[model samples]
Target: MTPTSSDTTASPDVSGVVPPTVTAFDGNGDVDPDATAAHAQFVVDGGANAVFPLGTNGEFALLTAGERRRVVEAVTDAVDVPVIAGVGAPSTRETVANAEHAASVGVDGVVVVTPYYYPLDEEGAVAHYRSVAAAVDVPVYVYHIPSKTGNELSLETLGRIAALDGVAGLKDSSKDVPWLAQAIDANPDMDFLVGSDSLLFAGLELGCTGLVSAVANVFPELVVDLYDAYAAGDEDEAQRLQSTVFDVRSAMKRGPYMAGVKTALSLRETDFDVGGLRAPLRTMDDAQRAALETDLRELGVL
Candidate 1:
């Protein structure tokens, strides 16, 4: 359906037609709103239509619920841009609390990942999302990334939430473009986005409404260029840019994604620090640093 006009024009499901997402960090690894705001404006200035402040790259898992709220406040107030905060956590109660906090802070929407740490059955997962959706008035977009959460959102769950008024969208970051495309196409009213840059070449062509690509955090212009190219029907140009994005996205698998991302920001020495990573994860050594630097140099990120 097209957007209605009072002499009007159509608009997409989410606030941003092309969202350039970033991971915000403080000097001591704590969540800092001011730094987040600065990073967000940088993305906005790069021509990204929207800014998603906290996601996997933001290290949402490690951040306390209170810290997440602070980030939501920081990024939303930082720019006139739309901020979608990640509210997914282990328990429905905690997630709902975070969602409520997000609503109180005035974010455009909340991105809730599926239930993790318990491997809930389909019914339990459905109940988890429904609980959060019930608590808040804003749009609730489901995050379907089984890789990190160990809990998957089946297509069946997607269909159930698609019928809800408050459940407006889904960001399937599983890196499975075909499945995400299918899940989203099943419900036209639900805004669908693939949270990866690797398959963006085929993804945009399949009807995704926006992108929450982590790579976009490093190269906002390149991501926006791909989106603009497609909107202009310049598929060839978009693909070329998207291919470069996919190559860079390979860093996630080579080692720790957060380290590489934070390292890249640290390389800029722009005073934006993700706070030295949490346990089970360590800082980068000189060799890893050199490897990333070499790659960033090739990608022109450094």
Candidate 2:
């Protein structure tokens, strides 16, 4: 009996985990394990309730399959935090394999994105996630960011996956706020994280549980502060901080998501250059770096 998109009793017991944006590095375009650990600790110390390794912001699409596995393991080993592995690929087999690996490595959960670079329609996306979730034992977070992947996890698709046993959450990165509201109300059981930091304050104000933001990698404390404040009815402080956070969020628009985040970290510290975009993405230019700095300095973040 194929399950309809109405069931939600079997979802995992994950209540308040802020799947943090991850960092990448290497001496020769490889997974630098130590830096990985350091970055994991950075988020943990900054107060991320959990970590989401190999996310799009982690440049998962750019890394090799083996490197992805290493990252999932590195982050899980680095912190006492629960790691939700982002195990999405262009094919079901690969996604399932990654999910199985995440479960094998003992990650707390797996966040699965829709398979990009393919004409995956609603039915396909639904099937892809269901198969991936069934292959692993941990909870699964359905990643919905259409801008980069060329695929959007529609409310119908999201509901279907949420109905499944292992699909426990949805990472809504779209700019559409109404559907996000719909998704939250639609799946009262599954955790729906605000995948966009710019909307984090407003999203939480409306009832979002947490955020899976890329910018969180740069200013985790600020992000966590908002989460804590909003949850505790500190609307006065949340609005004030949200306005100031724009400087950092604005600079991120200057380049690719991961590159922009890495650049921000580089500007703030002496020991954090993870090197260029994996490949195809040429290294950021001097002018671009200057622009990023300008934004950071304005925010007083640098």
Candidate 3:
């Protein structure tokens, strides 16, 4: 299918606790479209400013191309907020295909990560993102997570990529404070969404537009409150909330990251049956769950 034009003029103003939503599954281990839609709605109702479907926490790597498109369709249909689909694949062609599919489905933007498995040089990374951005008109947020992609996008290379026509902003999961600081300083026009919940307050203090936090999948209201408080200039409240959020994040990080998210969601008042993680990613053991529950209770999230 030909890529649709995303001439939506204004760049999407996406910010604040956009959950890298988990792709809900049924017992059969297939993508449960209805449950996935319900989960998206669940988070939005819980106070997410936007929905980011098929991201790292959503297990984008495990999903097939068709599943990826379908997940975006379901999420966009379910939420009124901007849906930024993660179209990062190991190859440029696949990433472009995913971006085209996201555009065709009417998602507001696409988050394209560095092509993984095979490390790409600065020029290769720039070219990869440029081709994907040119293939569609929708806003593109460069996803920088060298820890997972094995290709660290340098500040210079990132600047070049940000200058692309359709590029809108960046989501930095790199956790490299110095690099993030440099990127923020160099690209004043870009909207930087921090991917770590632990950095929510710090990121906001650094002038980050918002957070794309995994913890939001479980505690959307708290995450939203922290962002709102900080944005509202309520430093004391934001600081308190950030500390509590840090504790919750520490507990979740005790297990497999995404599985911990799904497990935590299962305990919430959600309409979706967010089954389990995809293959090779198992749920937390009984002891881990018990410890997590205790921590959540202490944090008043249970």
Candidate 4:
């Protein structure tokens, strides 16, 4: 059931596990809308609280603007859950346009990462987010992933962005728990979702509302289980599930970042094919796959 204009509503409580979903491609390396939608539905049916298309794991960097919009459109149409599209680009104008396009496609929100390639100061960062928030009616989330983007969102910058009227939340991928803690302290009303699955337990401990994990692409239930257990005050259960998530994550990290996630999805034997990583990132070789298979078998995730 594809969501229409009327169905585009912001998620009131965007807490819990949300997968930064992967992009599915055809044998020709073109974006496969059918496969993309199917994968989105797969994750939602597997217990994803929301589906995050066009995220880092989704190869947002490699896709063209039209492809990005199509990915969002397909994912939003496939799932009943909220769809948060990653609209981050190299420029504010592009980012704003992407967010606006995503909004038109019926996404519940857009996650904008800091501009990469060029370093941005606090003022520039604030202005970038301000422009995007002003350009879109849907919720805008600041995606703080410094390692890839080379731009960091300082606490003051986060506070400024949070003050924007259309800004809804933040996704911290910095992996710096202390910085995330300070950002949370700086903006008490803002919703913070961690990007690293390894920090799911720690992020929860630090009052994070949710996690935007790559590993969730392979094991949505584990991420959701950890969040649910923690939310239910089952500390022991959360810890156990987190340990399992860590195991799976460790296995994937052994290969190229996003490739391993796609490979694992393929190994799971889902109805839709995740295929290989987009160019510039190669799929795992036989040896890497064997190691990952060994890890998955030992953990019983396969």
Candidate 5:
């Protein structure tokens, strides 16, 4: 399904288990748009409410500008769900350009991570988001993953960003419950997506409307069930699923950073082959793959 042109004034509903999908690659380390789109479709078919491409899982930092744009285009064309492309770069100019490209391709919205490498002051962070939000007509969701970007956004900066014209919400992976709760309380109207699998239930309880789960890329049904149970007011079921997710998360972390999802996908019954992570980011070795498979089997996820 082709994505329709984005509506600038209305914020797209990004609430639910949205997978920050991995970018599929061919053997030569080239981006494979078809395989990437198929992975996106796979998650959506597994009951994911939406899909996010070019995120951390997508290895956004490694891809060239052209590769990033192609992934966005392919994923948007493959699924009828909201596609929120990750358009983050270290520089505001590059980020704005990425966002503009994403919007031009008909994404529902864009997720902008905090500028990395150089530490940014609160004012700089706010101004960066302001410029990105102003450049595109689509709603902009702030991506706050400090561990990766090396730039942390404070509550004051977030409040200012939330007030921007086309700013829609935030996806917080900081894992700071107090900070997340305070942010939610402060911005009653802005949507919040819990970006860590460990805090999905907690995030929902703290008033977050959505989840941007890396676990969802491999086990979309598990995350979706958790969300549905909570929405259905079945706290017990949600908690049980959350426990299950913890197990799954542990098993997926058996390999190198960001390797588990793709490895698990290859091990699934469907035997999906999205290829290995691009160089510098290694794939699971033989031993790691064996261990991961055994763990998944014990958990009955494989």
Candidate 6:
């Protein structure tokens, strides 16, 4: 039977800048729980309302199941703020297992990306989410990133998923504003999070309550300020910061995909040694790093 959206209340406040933090690794190319937890604390201290580990920025697909569980434990233990761990996997069974483990570790919620690599129809998509949502007691936030997942949830499908018991909200990284607008309009009870750094302000303007931002991983203050400005009724400041974010996003894309955030973190004067991206995901080369430094310095973010 298809479960309808239960009157399960929303999860803890996830309504501000939530950084999809990188999973910190050590010299041995293994998960460094302490370092990973420390990074989570760093963002919370930097004004992030919450921390989301094991997302795309965290390289969730690359980590082992045990490693992902350790990250959830470490981050949840390290910070007082809510931790929304990414529990998405390629299969519904794996996603349910991940979500159950995350909930076991006291994560405030789990963000389940749509099953990826294989195409899914609306019914399959809804069933996948329904299973995950039913398996865990914690709130489930659907992660809609078609660019990576290769599965896009239609508005009608999203509505059905939103109705599932324990399904709390969604993070739309689809970058389709019209679809996002329609989804927001259709499900006013569910919180919508904008997943792209480029669409933060516009997403908030469209009634999104929170931002699941990659840029926030390295520069939480920038994104937090953007959210605060909008909440404070400072539209001009919000837009100005959004423009700045556009520049930062462009600069971060200077190197191979998903490398800039870690590179930028290393470039900062902080004591964080996040090691580097796992194998097959290269870091920024010297020349690209230099260019990113120049861009950030010009923007006064360095």
Where model 5 places Cα greater than 4 Å from the true spot, the runs are: 1-8
Better of 1 and 3 by TM-score: 3
> Which has the greatest TM-score?
6
Better of 1 and 6 by lDDT: 6
- For residues 87-187, could you state the per-residue lDDT of candidate 5 as single tens digits? 99999999999999999989999999999999999989989998998899888999999988899888988888887888888899999999999999998
RMSD of 1: 3.5
Computed on alpha carbons, the lDDT of every model, listed in order, comes to: 0.72, 0.75, 0.86, 0.85, 0.91, 0.90
Clashing pairs in 3: none
**Residue pairs that clash (backbone atoms under 3 angstroms), model 1:** 5-8, 29-275
- Candidate numbers, best lDDT first, in rank order: 5, 6, 3, 4, 2, 1
**lDDT per residue, candidate 2, 105-208, as tens digits?**
88877888888888788789888887987787677788888888888877887777777777777777887999889888887776777877688887886567
- Worst 10-residue lDDT window for candidate 4 reads 1-10
Candidate 1 Cα outliers beyond 4 Å, as residue runs = 1-27, 251-253, 269-275
As for model 2, its CA RMSD to the true structure in angstroms is: 3.4
Residues 1-302 of candidate 1 have per-residue lDDT tens digits of 23322102222345333443454555565666777777777677777777766677767777776777787888888877667778888888889998999889888778888878787787787787778878987778888889988987778877876665577778877987668878867877677777777767676777887877766676777788888888888999998888788777775345664566656656666645445665556567788877877887887755
Q: State the local distance difference test value for candidate 1.
A: 0.72
List runs of model 4 lying over 4 Å from the truth. Answer: 1-11
Model 6, span 184-206: residue lDDT tens = 99998788889998899999999
What lDDT, from 0 to 1, does candidate 4 have? 0.85
Clashing pairs in 2: none
Predicted structure 1, TM vs. truth = 0.89
Regions more than 4 Å wrong, model 3 = 1-8
Return the number of clashes found in candidate 2: 0
